[model samples]
Target: MPDSISVHFASPAEMLFTDPQGRKLGKDPVHNVEYNEISGGVYYQESIGNPFPESSSQNDESKNIWIPEPVSGQYDIQVIGTGSGDYALDILTYDQTGNSKDITQTGNILSDITQEFELNYSVVSAEQTKLQRIVNIDIKPGSDPNSINCKNRKEVISVA
Candidate 1:
């Protein structure tokens, strides 16, 4: 059987609190943005934003991508980023004791950031582990004001 997990687009401001009377108050927690096509608008005041995908400079040190509390089992990790300029993908694993391991493929991938790209990966096994990886994408443009930063991003859906 394949276990499934969903990564939703939600705001950081969701939490539940109750008074001594145990009355539920405040707005209902929202996990996804509501869009109204008839009104040609987004209905909610709060919007779910994508995480900023970044790359290290040539001379600067690289940072480890961290996905804390990865459940033990098989997982399909889908990393998506702006496919506009340059990009690289790397996968790493860390055990419960914080020992790190790298599992990145050594060659160019079919998914490149010069356009839009999505890459699927698998986590076959783990020992009290976490996945620390990153899909680093960079966008650079010259002269044309119309050329701007590419910013769409998505992540993995796991099957246990």
Candidate 2:
């Protein structure tokens, strides 16, 4: 059995949060975002906003990635923004029932924002027969011009 699974991001845009000036303003400079994981009765919390430093040159450092003990059933993955900018986040997890669910909110969020992305996988044991499951997430462009910062942005997820 696997104790914990690793979540990987292919690009910085999928992980990091940037400012209007394109300068990194978060503690996790490389990924530029904050994350919190709730699993196995443990409540792991991390602040996810750019408490803008007094000076533009000042940097507040923090962790961008989280790895928690794997739970057998559904779990929640939460993402929070640090500043007023465009954000694209990718989250992966397993669901015992293997059902698909999607939740999306697109708009010009003046203040801090929080979004949830869900991943589901069937429950299979070592002694049981091996099977393959496919999960797909499709992101399309919205009509709102002011809230359309993620245009032409593409991200892919593959589970085996």
Candidate 3:
């Protein structure tokens, strides 16, 4: 006779609601919302809006928001938006070795509606890196592609 052992893992997503300065905004008592930390990503009760300045003139430089990459291995990143206007999201990933990858997704949302999209990234030797990398996410209005704006209810999920 052979004996077998089973192992189970609980991977709840971690919700993050903060500004660029790492201020805790989602945990406010007024909102009264809590998020669960999953294995690969987070399950936020609400979405995160873009925090970049809108470009006024052609000579103005584009604004970009930077966020540290969560995991080290390959993952499927997802983003969701809810609004009436159409917006574009630009994602840029940078590794410790100075390698970078870029991804862009468009969301044409209507009034009182929602839209979602996903991007996939694979790292060959993720184990080699001891620390997580950084990823810059830029959101802008579709009409003014070069300018930046805040996206309402932007949800991000990472599944390894």
lDDT of 3 by residue, 1-160 (tens): 1111111111112112332222321122223454323322232232334355484422212223333443344232222222234444455555544455555544454433222222233333222322122234454434433543233334433322
Q: Using alpha carbons, what is the TM-score of model 2? A: 0.31
Per-residue lDDT value at 104 in model 3: 51
Local lDDT at 159 for model 2: 29
**Local accuracy of candidate 2 as per-residue lDDT tens digits, 1-160:** 2333234322112232222223221233235533232332222223444476664643322233333344343333333444444443333333333332222223222223444333332234212212121223353344333232332223233322
Candidates' C-alpha lDDT: 0.29, 0.32, 0.32
Error at 9, model 2, angstroms: 8.6
Give a tens-digit lDDT track for model 1, residues 39-134: 111122333233543644222122222333433443423322212223333445544444544444322222221111222222343233333334
Which scores better on TM-score, 1 or 3?
3
Total clashing pairs in model 1: 4
